[model samples]
Target: MKLHGVDYTSAPSRRKGITIASGELHGDVLILESLTSLPDHAAFDAWLRQPGPWLGAFDFPFSLPRELVEHLQWPTEWAPLMRHVTSLTRPEMRETFKAFCDARPVGGKFAHRATDFPAGSSPSMKWVNPPVAYMLHAGVPQLLAAGVTIYQLHPGDPDRIAFEGYPGMVARDITRASYKNDLRSKQTPARREARERIVGMLEAGQHRWDVKLDAGDFREALVDDGSGDLLDAALCAVLAAWAWQRREARYGMPEFDALEGWIVGA
Candidate 1:
């Protein structure tokens, strides 16, 4: 946690490739009516897998939600299962998960995404959330291969050597609640305003980035996605936005330090 680098979900494309982080969106991407501004899922993951000094992101969890891990009884716990998921083919993974869901209730079935923070994530195996089931499907396997630490499906104990992040907790601090975290309909205008306020805070340099055991003053941004796919990614953008600042400042912008505290101010 030495404030090495930041993470971003290649999303909400502001242009073909420009101002990627100037607190400004491109004219074409800002039309407010065109979906062109939104980056595709493929593009998003591609950006995430890019090499270099990033911390982590909201694209999808480095780990799956605890709820799903337990329900599937996939044993993604210690060494074997963790190693298991890492090597299984996507088809094998699909068939196995499909069987489990096939036996669950109709209203509540698929797995939930780890980014469904504060919203009180489902049992993960609960399908009412849909795609996240697939997220749990597509995401977890990758973490295994990368050798990233994914304890209890949340980076609990950690790999001890690796450094990855979920990035959504930073956003949840805005209102200290869940609804605002949902990408679904519950994300109200008030929630949007709260996130904007925190973003404003960063722009004005209003908090300490120090990771001391006792350093206070933390501030961050939050955004509710209509589709949870980009929820974590968007949150990562916000994290990266702040990171862009901290990095530009050489980690001396009062928002970074030793081996603790969240990148956003915690």
Candidate 2:
């Protein structure tokens, strides 16, 4: 089976498109085959419609925290919950999430999914500092419309499986130093060096999955892209390949609430 990894953006543009890495798993190595950029949601939708005996690991939250959902009294079921969420406008989502946060204590403001701590991901309800809530609003609806299977959460085409992946988790395993920045001025040699270190670790199969990365000529490109979009997509590919290796074991996922999806290899 082919494996795919997506570095998604809520608002895609020429500069910050949804970046995808497609590859095949060969023994313990993931050979990245190609990188595709979807500059708009239309492009992403078209990509999703492609025929698949493929599994994708997307860098976005698949569901909201059950605690937040229960507090909001939204639909408990996955499809119904997503349907309710998609019906609202972005402003509506922001205000609602803001109200939720406003009612809680300072440090404990944001509600978190069970997977967040293990995955080292931001709260799906957060509207800024990555704005994952907006990402969920923008991305999940498209996934639902495309009719792809969302692993344990929803059933669609079994050949097209989707798993939530956190590239930060993989990067943290290799180094705690900041390795990426979007601003040209902040893209220093230090960050580039960190990216080089990450690439070396991946090629050497030094991370938790013990899966090597064969990026070939793309290695320099991954390190050179100071925004880290390409590298994040590549990391997601490695995680997807790891999941493919453990397909019979539920894609290396633990039994968690279906209402709150998991981050693969968390």
Give the TM-score of each candidate: 0.42, 0.99
Candidate 2 structure quality by residue, lDDT tens digits, 150-234: 9999999998988999999999999999999989999999999999999999999999988899998788899999999999999
How many residue pairs clash in each candidate at the backbone level?
13, 0
Which ranges of candidate 1 are over 4 A from the true structure? 1-49, 62-73, 76-126, 143-168, 176-192, 204-234, 237-266
lDDT of each: 0.37, 0.93
Please give the distance, in angstroms, between residue 170's alpha carbon in candidate 1 and its true position after superposition: 2.7
**Cα deviation in Å at residue 75, candidate 2?**
0.9
Reference-based lDDT, residue 41, model 1: 45
Report the lDDT tens digits of candidate 1 across residue range 66-138: 5556666666444444455556655676676778677879965565443343333333333234333344445
Q: After superposition, how far is residue 212 of candidate 2 from its true place, in Å?
A: 0.7
